[model samples]
Target: MLCVLSLAPFSSPSQSRSRSRSQSRSPFLPNVRCLFGNGKQLQEKRRRHSKADAISTQEVLDLFDQLSTAQNPPPSIYQFNQLFAALVRTRTATDNPVFSLFSRLIQAEGISPNDYTYKIMMDCCARTNQVGLLFGFLGRFLKEGCKTNVVVFSSILKSLCWENRIDEAAIIVLDKMPKMGYAPNVVSYNILIDALCRKGEIEKAMDFLHDMMSKGQEPDVVTYNILIRGLCHNGEIEKAMDYLHDMMSKGREPDVVTYNTLINGLCKNGQIDKAVDCLHDMISKGFEPNIVTYNTLTDGLCKNGEIEIAMDFLHNMVSKGHKPDVVTYNTLIGGLCKKGEIEKAVDFLHDMMSKGREPDVVTYNTLIDGLCKKGEIEKAVDFLHDMTSKGRKPDVVTYSTLIDGLCKKGETEKAVGFLDDMMFNGHKPDVVTYSTLIDGLCKKGETEKAVDFLRIMLGKGLTPNLVTYNSVIHGLSKLGHWKEAFNVFRELVERGFLADDYSYGAFLGSLCKQGQSKVVNKLLDLMIKRGLKPSIFSHTS
Candidate 1:
């Protein structure tokens, strides 16, 4: 739903025609005057009349009827209603009523659909993923002599590509444009190129770039940047670099997007040195690296285990008048955590707060995971408390990590207590939470409590995932309760679970430990029948 509009306005012929008509009529009348003379007295009468005036719905309807009766009529009052419906549909969702209302207005009042009408409906359809309806309406518009311009095509092009209709997008771009008497603008080319790149059609994207020039249409900076970004996105770093070089050779300066695109790709592909070189390349070209550019490079360095250099780049970003946002802090924290720098990660969290940048859920989640991993479960718990005090409630992730941490530390009772508190706080325990707690309980010989929580999770309408089944099965089997474990296994198979590697492995191990060789052989046969091979450990045990 995020849209970026190119700022340069296109002046339509209709506006010019209106202006010409007004100018050809006459200039303002030199001696024009009100019949009621003295302007102050007339203004007073008008104010009194305006204050006393009110119009009934019936009166409004009558006026609309009168207006519609004329040939070449002005729009009726229902025009506003149709517009309102479209606006409402855009916000909430597009339903039948809004479309039905517009169709009715078009039929009943003879109100020809205008550009705004089509644009609004297309936007609604795009938002709701109703591309078929959008295409149908576009066909209607074409039949009605309304041309599909750049904006109209751009809106639906993304939808088509998103829905994996790349063929349709190509047809619209290459075949349909000339047939419809509309030339593809820069925006049109950008859409097609972006779509092709997203679909991994890098060669086709290049072909479109060539086709644009062959058709005598000039490609702008936006067009090249789209292709560059698309190539980079698909990890076609070499191809993206070629396009970047081609753009530079033409004296078309690569903007922030171009540099950022290449830098992000390089960093992501483990070419952090090259990405940094690209950043310096931008500076050489007299183009300043924006915060996004620096963030991408820093994140890449951090991912590459160059944590100190990444921090230095972050400091350089701050010195260059770029304030690090959440993404900046997240990259740093994530990198520090990766290197087992838990204290520094926590310090960064404190720094984020001291600088008035409140840590979002991701920030808290990262810190929580790091702290938990470092066996600082108490600090992680306290972090959650601090989050709540700062009015940022713990999300499912925060609770899940803490619960998992507690479970690992043999604090099953505290983990269960936390789950209860989470439920009371309106954060439902997902399957992962249940699985973690169940695994912890099963290991601690608390099979009955694990079973109880599993039942409650099911009662809450959450189906037990593979991990939940594995935990409970392993728990029951460990307690010499083979019947309950087998029952769970049966229930899982009945629900059409894949009886995946972990589940089969855990079951076979339990059966072996219990000396139930008969059940173990039968389960292995069933696993093979289901085309699931048991793990080596499962077989050897």
Candidate 2:
């Protein structure tokens, strides 16, 4: 028999002890009285039921052994089956201690992992971010003389691209593919195109798309989906819609994902009416709206300040047997935060927690950002402390948002302290983080400190962007350090870093402001020689 304990609340520890003493005085079987007190009977019933339902780990092992030791394996005993069995045993078995059972099977039973088996392993590795293992698996597959097919490689290609292993993925696609009896298919091209688009190289993706069509492979629904999603993500909404229309012209029915992606893009870009119309179109096309469809619509509605409509959609989702997951909650919280409804968002957070769902980092960050926006920095900091107390580590966004808030409040030193704390927390600052800090410093007449941060960024192998240089140049020029600023401008040009109109104008205006007419004319001549046309303002000034 398992012993269970449930302590009841009392006024004080002494009072609880006295109550226990009084209970013991009245009962002949004091332990029994304690066991059956209050809701203990129901707890005991559950305990008994749990014991009855328990299955031993040894029993599960024995059953698997029986299946493995069959006289003849199933006819469909593909290598994929072997790898899949290994994955299942490794990932799912709570009681199974030995995961190397498959290794023993291969050695004793002579069953080897097949091509499909290797593909599944590769795909699994990709999904789990064990992408480094994929190359070794691929090498093993080639050594085994197993042919690689589209079904086998597409998923691997996708995994590589998803993990930002684009260059390595490209080598396999472009150079090694033909030798391995594999040709670029629509899926292959789509993966590359999708990766390019993700990195904001839309022109490169489009060029590759054109090359793909020229190579005699017909683009399919998956191809269109990848392109459409990429275009929409890059804010080319008009072009993305054109692609959607193109899908119809090609007699391809748009899948639920296709509609949801476009609708989400529309909603994110604040085209709520268009998003609503897209929803109607999805319904009119006889395509059933899934949870994603509802959630996207709800998020869009919330973003558009249609909270009532969004809540109604949430209700509709449950009515149709669909339940919102963590993503749904996150999106709603984020939308509400964006609209300055943090109090309502906090209520939703409490509601979610009561329902046994935990708020993730995004949820906390959203609430924290909203609080900071309302100038409730102390409350925001309290929420952050609460997050840490709950054992949730703060990510870059958490630190970045707080730093930005601090900078906005003229708390530069505090912001720097937070930045230092972020480094201590093992989170490297991004470009945006640096930009914000630099801008803040420049505003507070801490130009030298800002330049120092910029140098440190570059020293850490982070690229100094146009914004970094522009900030430094502007700050130096404002301090009447014309020579130093001009030196930077010359270095930027010499390094082939493209300066925007503002940077160009600032540099030219500084020269003109200093009454260095000769140097200004010389700089204009040099600019024209470099094929950069002087703006009318620059020329006149």
Top candidate, metric TM-score:
1
For residues 507-526, write the lDDT of model 2, one tens digit per residue.
77777778988988887776
- For each of the candidates, the C-alpha root-mean-square deviation to the true structure, in angstroms, is 11.1, 14.1
Q: lDDT tens string, model 1, 301-350?
A: 98899999998998899999999999999989999988889999989988
lDDT of 1 at 435: 86
Q: Residue 100, candidate 1: how far off, in angstroms?
A: 13
Clashes of 1: 0
lDDT of 2 at 225: 82
Could you tell me the TM-score of candidate 1?
0.74
TM-score of every model? 0.74, 0.61
